[model samples]
Target: MLGGAGVLLGVAAAPAQAAEVSYATECIPPAAAGLDPVQGTTKVEVTAPATAKVGDEVEVVWKFVQAASKNPDLIDLPANSVQPSGTLKAAGAQSGDIAMQGPRENPAIAKGGAMVLSDMKGKLKLTTPGEVTLTPDAYAINVMSTDTKCSPKETVKSAATINVTAGDGGSPPASPDPTEGTSPPPTSGEPSPSESESGSAGGGGGSDTGGSGGGGGQTDFTGKEVAIPYACKTPIGDKNATSPVQINAKKDGGSYDLTVQFKGSVMDSPADIPADSVKPSMEVVLGGADKGKVHVEGPTNSEAIKSGDPMEIPDLTGTYKPGADGKSTLSPGVLTVKALGTTTTCTPTKSAVSLTLDTAAQEGGAAGGSAGGAGVSGSGAGGSGGGLADTGADDGGMLKALGLVAGTAVLLGGAVFTFMPRRHASRKAP
Candidate 1:
């Protein structure tokens, strides 16, 4: 969870005021588990700037006062297997819920033992100027593949309030104007000189194949020079890095198939990164007509990268179905990279829309909804089909070793049971 705090720190420029509050929370297990709800008292300390100007990005931190307890089932949990996410409701000046996510942080915990949960952090851009009250809202705790959602049992009175002031008129814009001279020149009977130059520049941009037109009338954005600013955590410490991204989308029946290509970057590492150990997942924020987020995942690096060598990131892909009609815009949100058993998370500092498209409303329920409330949605280390890799040994050898262990355990169990006495049947009374 501290990894997430490091990512948010990159966006903050000044010191912040903080307040601590405690409340009673009730948590319910997933429907499939068919378990009763549990109640617990939790304390949290919220940190945020007391004053901020409009359009200025500020960071909000939520530190858990103590580690969370294990579930009622008392199942043992592995290291880096638990993650926490929640919403912070804002009222008065700004009135929307902000989603926060923390990286997986915890040592191996035995049954009924305490589970270490990381602190949650998120960033919000001040849109209006006034006093905004931020109250703690609902949250979800994910252990392995199961999720337990929790909320305040009673009304939350204690909160953090910030006074937002108007920004200076001279502050630079957070994003590039989409209508600026970014469009390609029109094609005529013969290509104009400017058109030829534009095409040449697009071709030499990067690894993306510059073209549009895929099956089902798809739009491709290959070779587009769009650099997204990200606050990243590396092995050494927290660092900011920007990398170009390629996005393509096409309407598939009532849904859309989106493909995102992240041209990997080479970053200096203090320690060597093992092969097939790095996995990345991204959360794409939806705006305009639709208001939600979509989760996308990428494959792991195939080879090992030595210390100080450049690391490579693979492309990501996911499917999204529109819930409402009209035009929608897709923007990159948080980026999570896990390497060498340690999780590093990154978030975009500024707004950058990857694509905008129009679609009709769906008749049924939306397939992919936002995982959290606003901002980037919280996701596990391995979402969907993506999980950690088995390193060091071959698959066959690992299976054989597991079989040997199982066989020895069975023999030991028989030896112990041989001397144990069996229970006699109970007699019924007339």
Candidate 2:
């Protein structure tokens, strides 16, 4: 009788499974129409210790660069025109952007005209034991001068990952008592209270797969929210300390369906941020994709995220390829919302964002035919620099070269004319 009931439940739930995929697809918006992103690209590089203990504070240095000569020009305004800021906060650590205005020193212009924004630094306090992906929020820069009539916007985003291990004997310090042995923390290896509850719910249905069963393969972010602070000048000269963003993942066959929602105050980022003036978007470069592809999708205001409603980032649904080690690393991309009303673009609070995926269960069962399982690789660094120095030939030098060429041509013509006349006269005399 119990087995028969289980079968009936499965049959009823089949429609829900199809709905999950449809929902995921509709959430993430397609690329903008007629607006091709700048031909230039940016990269992010990091410098930090390989491993650190929980509760320890560490400094993470970031170097942003414009990869090639085709790199787009950064928004150049007076120092106070637009505020450039970001944060180092991630899953385990707590930190903030070091320089509020911009990088302390002007970035260097390297050979091949690569723009390098180096020495931008920040600190993070490790609170949990696990690998944390550090992706600063989308730092908007002015791509045009202050005089432009209508200034379209561009963004700067990069990522890095840091591993935080347990302090004593590779275990998190749970209690202050010295006698108590080290155990992993809440976000660590051991199951959390929520995960345990989720697992119990799944066990009853006989659908509990390997690992913590949050919908069998889903990553549950039930009560938690990712906070990203932002500050800007021009349109609204204020800073938002807390902007709550949520990410929910559900297993969809071999892939995962993700739903990202924005909650809390509608005026968090900008109190009166005009919905039409603001272009909200997100770009993700995950390693688990087909061929190490960077997927850019957003402008969610149309479908998933509306101006007044709590916007949801949809279509983050895809199968993650596991690496050779049976695990896939994830680097978080920037969530950008640009305001075209003014020339300035603000920055997000958390820049370095990342997550991990355990694909061993799926690989062992269905994807075992592949040789090397796919995994998420770390993202590269971007660079920025001041405008190229004036190095071309001056007007005086150009005139001088022109004059010399003209004089040489005249002299040669005169010599030919003189010699030809002499030869003709000699022939007549003979």
C-alpha lDDT score of every prediction, in listed order: 0.50, 0.30
lDDT of 2 by residue, 239-304 (tens): 222233333344455554433333332211101122333343343333332223223233423322
**Tens digit per residue, CA lDDT, model 1, 204-300:** 2223222333234543322233445555443223444444544556566767666665432323322233456556677877766677777777666
Of candidate 2, the 10-residue stretch with the lowest lDDT total is: 17-26
TM-score leader: 1
Model 2 Cα shift for residue 123 (angstroms): 57
Give the TM-scores of the predictions, in the order they appear: 0.38, 0.25
TM-score of 2: 0.25
Positional deviation of residue 387's Cα in model 2 after best superposition, in angstroms? 50
* 10 residues in a row with least lDDT, candidate 1: 191-200
